[model samples]
Target chain A: MQERLYSAPGCTSEERFGEASAAGETLGERMRRSLEQDIARGDLAPGARLDEKEIAERFGVSRTPVREAFRLLAANGLVELRGRQGAIVREIGVNQLLEMFQVMAELEGLCARLAARRITPAQRAMMSDIHARLEAMGEENDPARFYQINLEFHEVIYEASRNDFLAEQTRSLRNRVGAYRLRVTYLPERVRHTLKEHAEVMEAIFAHDAERAHAAMRAHLTLLGDDLIDFIAQFGKE
Target chain B: MQERLYSAPGCTSEERFGEASAAGETLGERMRRSLEQDIARGDLAPGARLDEKEIAERFGVSRTPVREAFRLLAANGLVELRGRQGAIVREIGVNQLLEMFQVMAELEGLCARLAARRITPAQRAMMSDIHARLEAMGEENDPARFYQINLEFHEVIYEASRNDFLAEQTRSLRNRVGAYRLRVTYLPERVRHTLKEHAEVMEAIFAHDAERAHAAMRAHLTLLGDDLIDFIAQFGKE
Candidate 1:
């Protein structure tokens, strides 16, 4: 795991290069998504200075939309815009990151519990399909593919929970934690471990054991001991 | 409890018209806070229409800043922007509201659990002081005072949790839920009930019982049986 840097697994179209994704989004939205993918992929490293003029030129857009893109990124908690200091990709503080993971574990636990109780047959089938694909892909998975599919796997659970508001809140927080979580996909063994953990969560849900599902999901997401150390290690230089 | 509607208990400085609150907030931000208060107080009821020209005139500003204010309101989940049909005060669907409350319960539970373990002397004192004030206020509590102090009480727990990320997320969701929860403050007996629930939560926190604190807080926020019935009833003419 130390020898490997996390990337995509069994990946396809990890970055939605062209889809507007939502109504009313403009050039700023496209630029934000593109820049987000770059930052998530480590092409734009954490704490790296963001030159607005350079970005404008790179995106082949005017400074106005570029500024809007920066604002949106800041709102998403991916970038920091200091009054005089301009903007930079945010490198989350260790304490803030730990707090985020803690909250994430709890929210995932909630989703798993709801999903266990409410999942429909179709949703269950989809989750099973994704679970099987993850296992079947084995060594061929790319960090990009892994991230996209893993997101889909979780989306199924969120949908199965039949709680749109909860799902939206969970997804919003996940986006804020995106870059770091994506890094885990590059760790080959971590992906394998994640597969096993997902199996445990899936089993609990399949058994209609809400408490067990919640516990399994919480255990899967909570970092302790060596896991926490690995996260701190992967977090780049300040 | 049915005859008693919620309101304030020993409140002061319910609305801060004088303070800018934060730097860089302009006329648009000021308008946002004002309108938010109006909506929360039921001066602007859910499902009410918001006319851009009318609001611009009322706020003594140009339509430009008013539009920006509307955008901010929509972002806060207090307003719905409907293209050429114009904006309306958002009346959240029952299902979405239930989902929001569910997530809110989980988040508050997480805070309570953490606060139980990490609360410092200062935070503990602040919480106790607020609890005493709420209890001491008796029948004198107004809706505004009740809302304000209750916020302070929760803020102490959030601070005590030593998890800024979780606190920020919880606060953001609370803001989105403000209009609805403020209505709860107007239910007089609900405030009394809340005081009892807060006492339970405080006891668990003070005793350093993490699991009990978590359960207490979750129980405090969760609407159950007739509580849910009353919430729907008080949701107003929607």
Candidate 2:
């Protein structure tokens, strides 16, 4: 295969390099991630056709890999492939989003329960460190940095659960529902309240209080779900 | 693109029709389902190379579709794409299988819990019918029919949960771990025991006992995990 040139004039050298690294990953893996990012970033409009040749050319790969990527994306419910019409990005509906958030709450609750029981001392300390950084970051009111810290906080709970399969499935669900989650980040009260919930979750985990931890996680997830519902109702009126 | 002929002389008419239907399904979807079924049937041996051209020819489709199929399979962790080295079927060992079963149990538990609260009369009737059919199949000692009925029983529980995201995720995980599950069917006692456990789960769900249903589901899933572990220890020494 010839070296495929990817020419997006607006992309910085670093952004191009990142895209290249992403594309250069195993075709299937790269394709899945690329499509996900595109959907998340709103590059691929919902209901837009994802032609194999077009995607392949854009990603500088053969149709083989692109097809595989589409398959993965379709299975994730991100796309719908009709018999002969080709694949289209799926527009997730409100009910499905709510259902996803419900399950996410249960999984996070389980994670917190398990983390309270099994997280190591080192893991506990790491959670503390992340919480401290988040506190510092919150004082500065950097939404982006707070978001990064927020991911780390939840990731600690997931890792501490000691269930690889659960962690992986949860991550995938989070990714699939990421676009709508972006709305929740913009709310000032949501940000402050989320930080407080993170602290409570961390405290419960550190104290090894299983029920408390589970409750905390459940509360946090419920708050997120409620906020998302409100956010969508107010803005995502499609 | 030229449509390839599947003219293998020994293939039967129904087999041909089946093949055509499978092939005629969107190439990507065909590849995804074929790979999934092949893995479930243990047709594609673990660590097996999933040659793009070989699959393309076998499915009577272009490599484009074949590659797309591999991507979905890889996403489900059935295959691993090694960059330029191509893709290989993943060989899940005992520990990983155990981990998967652990997570499966939690998800199923969640399903039962939700089903207990949300199951309608019609859905409850469906569960009863499935359980009755499974019981009758168990009496006949027909493993294949019993297995099919068993899937219906769980799927009923999934629907009763009324959470599409949870139901879909459970279905996908169930498929990914199915190859190992096929081993449990060989144990005669296992079938009878699973049937009895299904009764307990159904009874709990019928009574609208959320906690009891959740507990029953967890107990049933634990047995599955134990049985799979034992089966792997004795027969799956890979």
Candidate 3:
């Protein structure tokens, strides 16, 4: 399989361009979304410099908004801003990637524990739907599609936990660490294993066994961690 | 007990101004430091608009660095960047404040659990020293000094955990929720209660009981939730 630059899949450039036409929004926020979409879609690369003027021209805005977008990115740890230096996209290392997965596991474990006790019927229905979609994709194994559904599956678990703050934070950290997850798509077996793990997690959650669900989620993330290390070793730049 | 603007008790304009010039850091980093100091010291109110030009002029730099600084702040969630509306400091309601403390409790609990297994002799000694200082202040009740030392006590726990990612994430979240933590101070008897809680947490960590340490930390943060609610009712903006 050929390696491609990762970008957020659902958001297209056309939609991003149309974002500039909206009113009452700061240029910073609009450009931030557009740029995040760009990064998500693999249009941008790690360590790439973000030229404020160039981006401003592209977005039909002043340097102010483009500059503001850069700041938001920097805050998110997506980019690094140097004093006299310009902003550059940050790259992830294997160690940092593993650390992120470890934290993600803990958070997922927490969500499962909460969801087991708190999940509503509607949320459980959503979880079932997402799990079904994810399970359907397991045989075909389209990495991107599987990943998307997988995200939804975990998100439903977070929502079922009935803790908005926990959900928001888990989502934010997930976004912050997206680069690493996307880069690990080269491992075919990883996809298969992840699908199997998701099945187990769903079963545990569905049974309302909080401890089992938490353990399953933790084990799933740990598997991702092991696969991530292998991918990074092969692909990581020195 | 007078309610005034959110300025540090001892910080004059000079001391606040000195933070920007004290180090030979880059413009962006220096500005970030200055802004954080202001926020921590209570000079910048939540929902306050940060005008780029004005901030640039204040720090004797161009809008470039100030804008970069804003991005750093936004990343930490100290401010929100509305697309065209400009950046405003974020405000947390009582429920949101409780959410933050709940997450804080979990993260700190994780830290203590790890620290129990990993803490070194030097780190243990440092923690003991910090606790002794906090204990000494129990009678004097010096809020400012106590607060500073209290921070150090938590820092040692995080560091002892020996996970860079978890420590950094926790520290960042703690700062992001700084305003709310400050609000909790106005609650009656909170200071005394907090000191007592700190001692219990320290004792657990010292005894190397991971579960006990985790429980103590969680209980401490739970009390903080009550204090924060009282503060919101008494002084929070409508």
Among these predicted structures, which one has the highest DockQ? 3
Q: Where is model 3 more than 4 Å wrong at Cα?
A: A1-15, A19-22, A53-62, A207-211, A233-238, B1-6, B20-28, B47-71, B80-88, B183-196, B203-209, B230-238
Regions more than 4 Å wrong, model 1? A1-38, A41-43, A51-65, A224-228, A234-238, B1-18, B21-35, B49-72, B84-86, B224-228, B234-238
Ranking by DockQ: 3, 1, 2
Per-prediction TM-score: 0.84, 0.85, 0.85
lDDT of 2 by residue, A139-162 (tens): 576655676678788898889999
RMSD to native, candidate 1: 5.7
For all candidates in order, the CA lDDT equals: 0.77, 0.77, 0.75
lDDT of 1 by residue, B13-87 (tens): 124434556676556557777777666655666778888888776556788656656766775578887756778
Q: Candidate 2's error at A61, in angstroms?
A: 5.3
| Count of residue pairs whose backbone atoms collide, per candidate | 29, 2, 15
Ranking by TM-score: 2, 3, 1
- Using lDDT, rank the candidates from best to worst: 2, 1, 3
Interface RMSD of 2: 2.3
Q: List, in the given order, the native-contact fraction of each candidate.
A: 0.64, 0.66, 0.59
Model 2 Cα lDDT, one tens digit per residue, B1-238: 2221222234432243247565446656656776677676566667777777866776667887677667668778888877777888888978788888877888899899999999999998888888887776656765556666788889999999999889988898888887767667558888778878889998999899999999899999999998887787787585
DockQ of prediction 1: 0.48
> Tens-digit lDDT track for model 3 on A149-202?
877888888888877888888887788777557657436676667777878887
Which 10 residues in a row give candidate 1 chain B its minimum summed lDDT? Answer: B1-10
Question: Per-prediction DockQ scores?
Answer: 0.48, 0.48, 0.51
lDDT score at residue A113, model 1, on the 0-100 scale: 99
Off by over 4 Å in 2: A1-24, A42-68, A82-88, A235-238, B1-24, B235-238
